[model samples]
Target: MADLVSERASEAKEITRRTALERGAGVAAVGAASALAAALSSSSAAAAVPGAKAQDTSSHSRGTTLPTVVAGVRIPDSQLTRAVTEFARKVSSESLFNHVMRTYLYGSLMFDRRGIRYDREFAFVAAVLHDLGLVKAYQTPNERFEVDGADAARNFLRGRHMPAERVEVVWDAIALHTNVGIASRKRPEIGMVSAGSGLDLTGNGLQQIPADALTEILAAFPRAGFTQDALDTILSLCRTKPMSVLMHPFAEVGRRHLSDFQVPTVEDLLLAAPFEE
Candidate 1:
C-alpha cells in the first residue's frame, strides 16, 4: 500500500496542475466548433479507465476549428449540443471536456465505418456530457457519476423541449456508455457512444478504424495528458465516495486506494443473500 501511494505520488508529480490546465486552455472556445468542423470537415477531443491502455501513438492534428458536423450529422452548434457543451465546458475540467468531444468523434466515425446509422445530434450531446458527474456541479454521494450525468443530460434535453423519446435515447446513451457488452446492444446511438469511449481509452476496436480518419480527429482534439487527468478524477471520487464504486469500473481505483475497500465477488453476494432458510 505504501509503495502504491508512492508510485501514485510520483505519477501525479509528472503531470502537474499547470500542464493539465494548459490542455484545457488548448480547446478552442465554443464558437470555434463550426470553424473546427470546416477544417477537417474537421476533428475531435479523454480519459483513463482500468484495464484499458493509456497510450495512444496517434499524432494529434492541431486545428483551431471545432467541427459542428461530423459523420454526416450536425453537432456542436445544434440546440442540444450547444447546451451540453456550454454547460459541460463551464463545469468540467478541460481534460474531461475534451474526452467527451473525442467520444463523439470516435463514436461517430466508428458508426460511419460500420455502415450503421445513428442519431448524430444525440451522439454529440451524449458524448459531450458523458462525464458530467465528474464535475463538481453534479457530484452527489447517493449516486455514481454515470447516473448523475444521465439525470443532468435528461433534464437538459427536457428543458429544451426535445421530444421525450429523444431525451430518453440520449439519457440511455450517457448512462450506458461504460456498460461494455450491454451498451453495444442497446439503441444504435447508445452503442456507438459506448464503443467510441472504448476506442479512445483502450484502443479496443482500433483495427476497424481507418488510420487517416483517426489522425484527423486526434489532430483537432489532441490527447493532451487525458489519461492522467481522467485517472485523477476517478481516484478522487473513489477516495471521497467509496460506496459509489461497487458496480462501476472505477471500483478498481477504490480497491487500490482505499484501505477498507472490499469489492464483493459473485460468490460473496450469493452467500450474503437472504434466500432459503
Candidate 2:
C-alpha cells in the first residue's frame, strides 16, 4: 500500500513538472500572438466608420482576412472576440481549434433556426475557449477538464476587463458545456455553447442545419481528424489524472484506453463511507 501510494504521488509530481515545462515554452508564443491581436484590434477600431457594424477582418498573418460570414451566420468581430480567436488559435491544436470554430458556427445556425436570441460575442467566446482545458498549458492536475477550461476562460475575460456578470456567464457556459441537460436549461448563450459543441462532436442536431450550410462550414474548417485527436487528448488527461475523471464521461475514456486505469465507483465510495451500520 505504501509503495502504491508513493508511486501515485510520483506520477502526480511528474505530471505537474511536465505541465509547467510545457506552459513555460508556450508563454512566449502566447505573448506574441496577444500583442499582434491587440495591434489588429487597435487598427480595426481606428479604421471603423461611425455606427458601422464591426466586420470580421482580424488576421493572424499579413494579407489574410478572417471570413465575416460562414454558412450565413455572421461571426462576431468585436475587439474581445478578435482577441479570443487569436488566443484560441495560438493555444489550441489545429484539430481542437477547428472544432471550436465549428461549434460556434453550428450553434449560431441553430440559434437562427430556432429563433432564439443570444449574444453573439458571448457565445463565440464561450465556444472557442470551451476546450482549453484539454490543452497541455491549461490542464490542471486535480480539476475536471471542463472546470479547468472554464477557469482559464474566466481569467482571460477578467484580464480583458469584461463585466462581472458577463464573465460569470461565459464561465458557466464553458464549465457546463458538457452537461447538456443542465446547460441547455440555462441562458441562451450558455445553452448554445453546449448545443453547439455537442452538435460538433456528436452531430445530435445535424439535421437542423441545411446540407449546403453543413458543407460550407466543413469546407471552411476541416475536421482534421478531430474525433481521434480529441479522444487521444482526453485519454492523455485520463492517464495523468485518473481521479479527476471520476463521475465524468472522461472516466469512460480512461477505462477504454488505459489498461491500468482504476477509479473507485460511486457505490464503492458509498460503501466505504465512515458508517458503522
Candidate 3:
C-alpha cells in the first residue's frame, strides 16, 4: 500500500510540473490534435473552434501539419467585418503589419486555442485585430497601445453580442500573446502553437532570420498581377522579425487555396534559429 501511494505521489509530482517548455508543448500539441480531429469529424463542429477563420495557413509550411477545415465557417458577421476593417486600417509599416499577420496566421495553424465557444470565437476575432494601436503609435513604441487595443477589441466584441467574459480572453490574448519567452500562469494556444513549432512570431528570440529566395514570387506573373508591394512589405518586415519566418511554412502548405500570393514562407525548413547564443 505504501509503495503504491509513493508511486502515485511520484506521478502526481511529475504531472504537477509547471515548466514553461512542457506547457508550451502540451498545450500546442493537444490543441493542434484536437483541431485536427474536429476537422475530420464534422465541419460545423470544427468551425466552432476559435480563431478558425484565418485565411492564412501558409505558416504551417514548417514541419507542423495543419488540420483541414471541416465545417468551413468563415467569420462573416457584419460587425466582425467592420471591426476587422477598422483594425486593418490602423496597421501600417512592413514590420508591424507582418508581425500581426504572422501572429494570426501561425497562431491559427499552430494553436487555435478554444476554451469556451463564444469566448473562443470572440477572442480569436480580437486576436485578428489586436494591433490597431500601432497606427496611433508610429512615433512612439508606447505600451499604452496594448491597453488601448484591448479596450477597442472588447468594445467591438461586446457590441457584437459577445459576452463580457469572453471579451477578456480577447483582451488577454491581444495583450499578452507576444511574450512567448516569459512564463505565464495561463498560456494561449495561439502562442504555444506558434512557439512550439519554433516559427517565431514576435521576433523576440532568434539568431538568424530565415532565407527567402522568393525571386520566383517577387515578379508579376502573366496570369495574375505580381504582389510586389505585399512582397516588398513582407521582405522589409523579415529583416527585423525572425519569427516572420513562419510565413515560409504557411505558403507551402496552403498553396492552391493561397496561390499567386507568394507563399508566406517555408520557415519550418530553416536550419538556424534567430535566438542569439
Please provide TM-scores, in order, for all candidate models, with all chains considered together.
0.70, 0.77, 0.37
RMSD to native for every prediction? 13.4, 11.0, 18.4
Q: Which stretches of candidate 2 lie over 4 Å from their true place?
A: 1-63
lDDT of 1 by residue, 59-97 (tens): 332223457654343455665565566555544444555
Clashing pairs in 1: 33-66, 35-65, 36-65, 36-66, 37-42, 37-66, 37-67, 46-99, 60-219, 61-219
Winner on TM-score (2 vs 3): 2
Overall lDDT per candidate, in order of appearance: 0.58, 0.66, 0.34
Name the weakest run of 10 consecutive residues (lDDT summed) in model 3. 36-45
Query: For this target, which candidate reaches the highest TM-score against the unseen true structure?
Result: 2
Best model number under lDDT = 2
Error of 2 at 41 (Å): 30
Residues 117-235, model 3: lDDT tens digits: 22334434654555543333221222233334455566556666777776676666554443333313354533432242233222332222222311211121011211333243233
Comparing 1 and 3 on TM-score, the stronger one: 1
